[model samples]
Target: MNPRSTATAHVDTFARDRLPPPDQWPDLRFDLPELRYPDRLNAAAELLEGGAGRPVFRTPSGDVWSYGELRARVDRLAHLLTRDLGVVPGNRVLLRGPTTPWLAACWLAVLKAGAIAVTVLAQQRPSELSRMCEIARVRHALCDIRCVDDLAEAGVPGLRITTYGGDGPDDLLRRPAPSTPYPAVDTAADDVALIAFTSGTTGRPKGCAHLHRDVLAIADTFSRHVLRPRADDLFAGSPPLGFTFGLGGLVIFPMRAGACSLLLERAGPRELLPAIAEHRVSVLFTAPTAYRAMLAAPGTYDLSSLRRCVSAGENLPAATWRAWYERTGLRLINGIGATELLHIFVSAADEQIRPGTTGVPVPGWQAEVQDAHGRPVPDGEPGLLAVRGPVGCRYLDDPRQREYVRGGWNITGDLYVRDPDGWFRYVARADDMIVSAGYNIAGPEVEEALLRHPDVVEAAVVGRPDARRGQVVVAFAVLKEGAERDAEALRAFVRAELAPYKCPREIVFRTALPRTATGKLQRFRLPGDGYAESSAREDAGSPTGRETGGDRQ
Candidate 1:
């Protein structure tokens, strides 16, 4: 659709009278001010100055760093980068390591020294790291000693590699002492502060360039509206510092709120629980899978200190939310954020939450459900989810920039429904929808229903190509411990709970479903040749009449 035509159509569907004016929303005090220098707006500089001599972070090892001490360390590293390493403004410095107070300091040091920081996931493979370095033209990489070997194997040449850990030449512990405080360089608002590489399910990764102002814009909108952290609140989470979700949860929001962040060197479900218990962490940010895993842990960990738990990266099932709140008094705040938006555009505070819904859009953003042609759908009808927020995403020279931004609206790949009261309920992605015999099915909806089953530990539903039907619903299930994986019994259970068309045509038992590093289910990996092999074995052993089930139309 043409740009002008699309805009006109969108306006007609969501007329001004039909939607509430943005100004009528509750005022959030965290909005970013227009700065004189856009390119050099360093968050570390702003927060450190305001929070000087105050505690910034706490570690489980009984280590604590006041803002003054953190700034002093950052200054020393900044000087070393400028003098010894010759790093300059706009230089892309790749930060590779797990979350640590030192890692946070290094991030600020790089930015404080006037260089753009590109955070690489510590768990990323050599090839993935290589692609990122090549795309960003990273001049320096501060990585863990364990990751240095992979960086070498990735063939990223001419890049200075600094290692962290025991006896390493460039260990953060051995960095030179600071002679003076590093001064913040003047930067333009449009200058890129960080580049986050998004995992592409279709093609090579794309770097989402976030401007300095964009950082504050996110903190202004979602953080103010959803989190509302106080100085006494200690924020922590399981997402690595590399993910924007973690960066916001662990550093930006807390620092913006003048609160302390607890940085765990290792953050998995196992590690996260202990850190929370030991440190009395009040706020958490993690994926739904991690929350589920924490509940499944063999031993009980004291989580009473936790006041707010935020879940993103994937759809939050109602069953997961109920299970979490029932076990612990905290409700998992469901927010929908994309790499483009930098943070969640929609979220609900604990008091305002509707269990399964993706909540109302933040004060500064507008969301609508649109049909295939980009026309807004009626309330309660599922369609493409489009959002327009203060923090706009500008891709680095990618054609997708044009495809994503249509008529001044960001068309997220997600499909959703907007209720009359304006709550947004997430459906499957437009690309992830399964079509069988002309029936359009959302995979996530089926997965959500399956999760409600007591015997089901985890399930991923995908479309499998069929000769009779265009596609058939196939479920990859991981049953609970001591639970039976009998195909017929499981199918019977699904048939009882879901519509005949929505029930899985076949159930394939697996030890576990494959997931991305961020804990999102990797549905693309399903319905591969492995499924065919498993199907062959199942069909060969099954009796003739048993193959056709009541649920199979």
Candidate 2:
């Protein structure tokens, strides 16, 4: 069967026409029976069915919304969008706000109403948001009442902005609703559902267009096969709904499993621990840095309720994984996923876990290590990680699509070494590889060595231009409070663990490492100074302060 889906329900056709030519698309397979969807499908409608009486979302304000209640809320919002806001099938709707039930509901409503959702983090500045809007040609927005300033400042011409979560007469939540039952838009399974924008090193936004079928495929493949959730489990996480990671772990995955999830607007490590025990959360999803911060914190959190914990966003050092296991008798499930592919395509759960290595691909996906020329590399050799599955990257109107999707494989740009036994160990991003005097050094290997130190709390390694060597390994570290900043001593510590050439000759200590709002390191933005910054970490590195979400797009 020709997998090309030619039929679409999009009336706007803007996003449809922008997709790369059919020849550039990655191979999409639906080997699993559950993955086969009807020609006409609505992802929100499929998920919101049959779990009426169970709690689906809970907030810190003691508000618990059941599946039935959430369905009503989404239907009402859908009605408002189509009836009052003039949204039609295939129109793009920008959703900007902190992570909350209202924001999640808005996302579902947009899909149900046959409108494409563009969910961006609240921390994104006006310029970043504007660029994404321009790229997606967004003409409508539903923003949180408190976060409207930036969207208003963006001032995209002809864009209609509606404020929600306020008492104003025009607010989405307060507006009178139509009493008629809102019928779900019967969209083709292959029709574009949302446009998620992810940035590359050049900071250029690439819009990934995902179909309605792709939404349920991630849940069926990863959540169903690996991070299996029970209907009675209570899920929680730190990634914002804008990120595919959070959207999967917190919303889509749970809803597909008939489970409940607690949505916290501020989900930093310090704030997350207490909320978990208070809410009796069973499954937790966050980054490796957050786990280390939680371990370093002084408080005695009642983490007995936590049954499963998943980590991503950065490589999980074996030391941190062991420490987390020692402190709490739970194994940290480490997985690597990309916004292009939606969620964690490679991960392990329960008995399938192996520390320091990302597990095998999920049930419906296939992964391999390939050289630059797209030829298969030998075992234990580092190469670009290529994956193809039920869902793949379809960058909207971007030339990079040819680079990302090569010969029917989605090249994730991550370097990995696949062992004979099929366990994939992450090396570093392909561009992040450092060549010092012709000796190739993966930044993550050096980072793991630094993280093994007793005083180092957070570490990032990058290459600096050197006169003699083309590039030299440089390490930026955030140490434990009151730890002495002795570059020589730290250097010696790393040399003891790694080869002398692979070790960082110079170390710069800092109070915290810089990260994106979605809690990812900005390696290119690393400062070259040896002095420590006075202020604490901005987003994720600090074990203190309140911040939320992963740079999840």
What does the lDDT read for residue 88 in candidate 2?
A: 95
Q: Taking the tens digit of each residue's C-alpha lDDT, what string does model 2 give over 254-367?
A: 999999999999999988999998999999988888899999998798999988898888788899999999998999888988888998888888888999998899899999
As for candidate 2, its clashing pairs are 243-552, 518-550, 518-551
TM per prediction: 0.88, 0.95
User: For each candidate, what is the lDDT?
Assistant: 0.74, 0.86
Give candidate 1 misplaced runs (Cα > 4 Å).
Answer: 1-40, 166-173, 528-530, 533-553
RMSD (Å) of each candidate, 1 decimal: 8.8, 3.7
Candidate 1's C-alpha lDDT? 0.74
By TM-score, the best candidate is 2
Worst 10 residues of 1 by lDDT: 544-553
